[model samples]
Target: MSTAAERTTSPQPMNPDEEAFLRALGRVMTLLPRAIDADMMRDRQMPLSEYTALMNLSEAPGRQMRMNELATACMLSLSGMTRVVTRLESRGLAERVKCDEDARGLNAVLTDAGLARLREAWPAHLASVRRHVMDHLEGADLAAFTAVLNRFPL
Candidate 1:
């Protein structure tokens, strides 16, 4: 067990520019997802995660991927991926198939209906993305921004 003094450490103070940058990053992180998710739900009748899952599966070979791979690609927990898959299945948009190479594994497959739904939502999704993000990036120094972003370990 440690006392308060032992458990506490002073944080290095950030300069004003650093502080402003961090605050702006925080606001963007918070607002971006909410805006995208709200637009998707309102227009697509599905949340962003489900759309992401569909999009990922649509791009995969055979329009299918192992559950673990799908989960990783979607940046979702296994259970969260499972729930999203279940919801898609209920909507006849996706199905789970037993992996041919690994009986213990399952694959998520995009159905024709899923593709159609994706097509239906594509316009709105693209428009929303353009409005919220791509528009802001237009004619900007993307190479520099990309390089800076790539410097981060994430």
Candidate 2:
């Protein structure tokens, strides 16, 4: 087996194009969610995180997911997902139920209200996504871009 040092080769300096791409990726990572969230909030809709949670729940099998799985799917920490689910519960949009197979675990289930809210928010969300992202990618190879994105660890 190779020693740790042998396995740890120095990374090459980024080329100018690579540097520019990295900078742009960083900016997008920072700005995209804020832009989408602002658009949603400005329109008197739920924030992007809540919308995302609802959307994920709406698409899950039986419109429910285990809390931890939901958190992973929503790119949130478990505690963060709990907070979002709590906000949703207060609004009658979602509820937490004891997991059927695992009594110790919980699941987040979307209510009819949540589905309705998601439907209401969909148009504005789509517009925001288009304005902030898709429009900029006009004529770009989306399949290739998606493939490149899939290379990253979730």
Best by TM-score: 2
Across 75-116, the per-residue lDDT of candidate 1 in tens digits comes to 899999999999999999999999999899999999999999
RMSD of each: 5.0, 2.6
TM-score of 1: 0.86
- Alpha-carbon local distance difference test for all models: 0.93, 0.95
Query: Which 10 consecutive positions of candidate 1 have the poorest summed lDDT?
Result: 3-12
Off by over 4 Å in 2: 1-7
lDDT of prediction 2 = 0.95
The clash number for model 2 is 0
Tens digits of per-residue lDDT, candidate 2, 1-154, equal: 6667766775557999999999999999999999999999988468999999999999999999999999999999999999999999999999999999989999999999999999999999999999999999999999999998999986
